[model samples]
Target: MPRSLAARIVQDPSDGFRHLPHLHTQAPDLHVSFDVLGGGRIRARMAGPAVPALRGTEHKADLGARPDEVHGASARLCARWKERFVDFQPVDDQGRALRDRQRPFATVADLTAAPEHELRAVVADLVRGGASLLFDTLLRGDDVQTAVFRSYLRSALSQQGLRIRFDSDLHLPWPMLCVAADPSAGKASLDTLFARFLGHRHQIEHTGDAYAWIGTPRTTQSQPVVSLNHDVRVGRTTKADAVAKVLADGTLCTVRTTYEELIRDFEQPHLDEQLMYFWCHGEFVGNAPEPPVLAIRLTDGTPFDGHTVRELRADYRHSSFRPLVLLNACYAGLAGASADRSFLSRMLIEHGAQGVLGPLIAMPQAFAAEYALEFITRYLRADANAGRITHDLARHFAAQYRNPLAFTYGLHGGMDAQLERANGGEA
Candidate 1:
């Protein structure tokens, strides 16, 4: 018997690549055209001449006699057919060859006004066929790009019966954000302070050069200590061991896993509750036919791409324990607003996480880890008899750096509220 389409559509958790065929080959009739725009105008161009003919006359004559050479020369002769021909021949679709010549504004306008249904059909076919398509557009600015991308994503995902939810409206407990990156790097500093202000009620897990608990100052009398010295590993197999070690030492756990294990663990119905802290470095490509994945380091010293935040959202709704996900990776929370869709943090809340905290700016790796640990330690272990733990945490860190940039924290949902209440205050 043949395998079901659903079975074929699902990717293997271990490898993370989809089991579908190439999108182009699968949809031979699909046609796509590019329009390079600058200052709100189109740019017309063409292909260059073929490689210089073979040196020897006899060899050139033999090559010229070949049908391919003849066809190549003929194609070059026609201005409209100068470039490489594909399913969407400019001449066939636009009635003009995209040659090395300038065209009037009307011509460009006519091409843009052409039936977009065909283009939509091509995109739909690629998605349904299970092939990932990357739509990389250089927009005017971050805000503009984000808006356009979000709109396009909504239109695309809605066709596939998926929706992006917002975190604030969901009212779930705010999740603890953890970072495990290189310390020398400043990427994780804000994250560390945020964790601390949350009352040091979280955990800091790392596999860097040293193994010691960097504790917060208990009182003005006692100094913060770093006493434990141990070897820490960063990949998947050691993730569980690291968590176990942290728990044994009576500290909160922030475990880092291989990209493959991250996906596998998310998909599994049962998850370890004690493993509360989650962090990783991965790519999040939205609206692609292939699932978005977190690129993680493997046990064999190779890198693997795991599933997207969407896949994780689905798993969270169906799983037993939905761990709060702190995606230190770039573009993780980049889902923009369009119709009813929200960002990745919102998706996590809808599925199962209490809440998610990530950065809006590109973070440096080492700094990200250090700040994350510091924040987690302070929040999980600090005195929070005062009110507004989450807000205070954010504020405290902001003050320490004495820079507004240091307080760049975006929160989604009630997880922030939960943390505040848990720390003995109201939000």
Candidate 2:
């Protein structure tokens, strides 16, 4: 009684409708399609009767019909298709289709319906195979209500490792590179949260611009230039004591140097530390004269946005403490042409950083602080006697905050053991 996927797509060909590959429908007039674009990305398009044009317009139909009607129908149709086709088969390392026998849908669904740990394994397998699932939901409500529901749907799908891309002529398409992290609604101070989470007094450095620090020190041996508003004397005392205590507790001690300090230190080669932690504001410039500079904040609250991946590769190609860099900035993952790794994580790993952890979306200050504190706590407090502890720590952090659109976590290094350990021996 229901039209086939392809037929539904053909009936309501919205703008750029010819691009998708699979289509299905529950009703004759309504339909949805699954389009496999390049880069292993997939999109869904849903269409039905065109709404009537506004007063004095040419098109004629029921403008009174809500947009959700179309969207809801599409979602229902796609969910059924996913239920029908959601089986698993083995594939090669390259994600190429292999000759493995297809398993039963009930088994896969049962796995998904299992506990979170089991569901994660199944989802990881799907991602590793370069396959993305899509759901097209039709809505019958005001545009505003529809938008709210769409956001909810996006959040739901992202938790399942699926990114939601909405298509509609009524609204402008969301930016391709932009991902939204839900902010903690209200007037909560991120600074206070950071202090509570870290269990220590900290300073806030607000640099107006973004930049990368090249050949910088991991920690500052000199006294920090404390802000005046937050009781400079007390802050300095807290920082000094915290630094000494952390170092005394067998944690590695490193200094965060300013651009000038880094330049001078690099020339003299004085400090001797293997691992480093860089905490600063950063920005990703895609089409700049020098692409993808990790902007570091200076002591005077100024941003020094200079230094490229190429320069780092050429200069610190062999530095022992090339220092794994974690960029706490927006769009830090997107890299430019000519660079094998554009994302800050990949760039840092290639440029000598042992590992990196950063958000793939615009991170809210509170979330960033929380995530950073957790990572540092794990790294500093966890026993390092085991193999690949750091990598596992990073993966665990990512899994906990897995939101494909609002937040994507990535890791790159030569340490396969670390990655595997992080995966918890699953997948």
Candidate 3:
């Protein structure tokens, strides 16, 4: 099964060498094209074996929409349940029992103990509500793109891995947009969208060779105090530990912690790691004239703003090294508006990474760690490529966990790309 979608441009620095080893035997199953025109206007088109080509179906993105409006709907929906739960009173008798089961919770830890179904209900509402906004806002009134997107949803629901290639001036986080059918309200329902597809399972890859596999873990916190957000035990170390164990057992890669160390390491010739994984903090610092810079921290807790990121990528772009980066950082993959373009993500794509994956919003540490572990483990053990492995793992994780966090991660690149394994064999 095809397990991922890829987006790239003809001007990609990696150029001819971006094709993966596994793709040598076959032709691409899908192709998506994007045209960025004068005055910030952008247009997109999707065609594949599963799609019926239609005339005049090219869809244009509304770059004119207020930056806030373009990405606001989904962000608000995600927070709706979290904020509403406090004031929500269960009207039915069962709602009381549900509340009791979830009571005595002052902190996130206490919240985590709530019944899975109860939590799922809240998330489902978010998914359904958010899907409508996405369809209307991002799909931008194009019947063809909407129809093709619906087919993609159905394919994902059927457990068939997806391999889509998108070419666009502006990167759209396709996975963040939800689509589901709702018969009762005469609109899409939450149930259908919630069951649409697991997010982490899909890989957004790029068409290129991996420079090398590298993992950087920033396990310790910058501040000494334990706040509610910080107190939530995230698998920061657990994710790093798991990857380290696997790599140490024979994966060809390097793991670094400090910013200085990582910078020095990359300056050397041996730092040509293709798969770059970072377990650190990511921030979206909004400013004028520069869009929003994604601020990622080093081991020493220093910040690397978007400009710095662009510079680093330029260095790599000029060299023979190109990487596929995975950021376990918050907001690194946040679906942003045209006004607040995803600086880090775009920087990476422009620099030469075949693809990049990161959470759209802040994700639970424990859950993120577990999810990474699952994706990495499968990537190593299965014959499927990275995208397929992600799809399968996400499917299992969503089925078992039932949390929407799994869907928050966004893929920006060739989700269909593959790499060699530590065992010196392609998986």
Candidate 4:
């Protein structure tokens, strides 16, 4: 892929290896933790070399948001954010997002299409607003010098090479979280509102629960298997078809249009696949008594959740069942209030999957299809890592169409994962 627009504008020369583990010591690292309480309250804190400890009276605020109230932020129901939320159709896994945050709800009609500038404004709002949901309370004057200091300092200190992780059970779209930026700081194109998102500035991750292999990890290189949703439409210029073309042209892996076939393979102790892509409907499933778990369905509506894999898969040997799962479904990236880890992601990680990339909100099918096409194309290249691929996609969409939905997708481990092309192998 060509240099990203933001990278080109800033003249920041970056490579796929920027997020490698060895280079982390030269710069600062950040770790933020959040503990969810009985109510919608969160007990949050942060620590890093860049974060200083203050010895004074701490001013803390009782900040709590009802899960239902926060739903309005993504709803089409006439409310404060409805105007901007209308641009991209969003769905919820809860299946309970109300029509309006306020009574006598209003609805917004699409204005043909939102202009780039208007879209960027919404991007800034969503990023900064999402950040505020978590950090605004973490920021009262005493707790923070400025909201920017907490979210942007460590990243700005290291520039584009950021080694940061958000250790929280609540999988609030971490990349979409942004702090306020000075508008008059620079006149460069890279300084546009689009560049202010956390994902655009850093190599990010969540719940760094890594498993160590009990034995020597296998070093063999075999052709990977690329699996797509069984329901992908095949025609000219179709996103799923285009993504299939990517695999076909590269001879990347053994491709299959699978649904139950995947379930059957995953039930075994060892599945010989490197990358698994799902382009089906996904949502959170649960009643109030039980915590919501994210789940996906193929054409047959077979429920594929963490529990499904745990019960079906045989064992967790280092050589078995490990693959990078691209869950191109809505809300697959979201985790509930339990610190256990992501529903699907944690299960995949625990089951030896390298990493999982998915969306945090209800993403439209068209965007998900297009996103899969672009992401899969880059995934086949040896020079791009998962983190860079996702972040770069955010920049690409923002620059090309001012769409910020790409940032809604979060990286669960495997930020540094790079795949060898089936034909070319590693560079």
lDDT of each: 0.31, 0.32, 0.51, 0.58
Model 2 C-alpha lDDT per residue in residues 298-364, reported as the tens digit of each score: 4533444334444434455444344444454543432222122234454445444544444433343
lDDT of 3 by residue, 255-362 (tens): 566666555654553345545777777776765665666777755776665566555555555443455577777777765555244666666656555567777766
What TM-score should be assigned to candidate 1?
Answer: 0.35
> Which regions of candidate 3 are displaced past 4 Å?
1-42, 55-68, 77-117, 140-160, 183-193, 197-240, 286-289, 313-318, 339-341, 421-424
Stronger candidate by lDDT (1 vs 4):
4
Query: Which parts of model 2 are misplaced by more than 4 Å?
Result: 1-249, 266-274, 286-294, 301-316, 334-347, 382-407, 414-427
- Top candidate when judged by lDDT against the true structure: 4
TM-score of each: 0.35, 0.36, 0.69, 0.70
What's the candidate order when arranged by decreasing TM-score? 4, 3, 2, 1
Clashing pairs in 4: none
Q: Which residue window of length 10 is worst by lDDT in model 3?
A: 223-232
Prediction 4 global C-alpha lDDT: 0.58
Higher-TM-score candidate of 1 and 3: 3
- Per residue, candidate 4 scores C-alpha lDDT tens digits across 271-345 of 645677877777667667777778777666666788887776536455545567898776777533453226777
| The candidate that achieves the highest TM-score relative to the unseen native structure | 4
Question: Least lDDT summed over 10 consecutive residues: which range in candidate 4?
Answer: 103-112
Question: Least accurate stretch of 10 residues (summed lDDT) in model 2?
Answer: 198-207
**Residue 350, candidate 1: how far off, in angstroms?**
2.4
Error of 3 at 371 (Å): 1.2
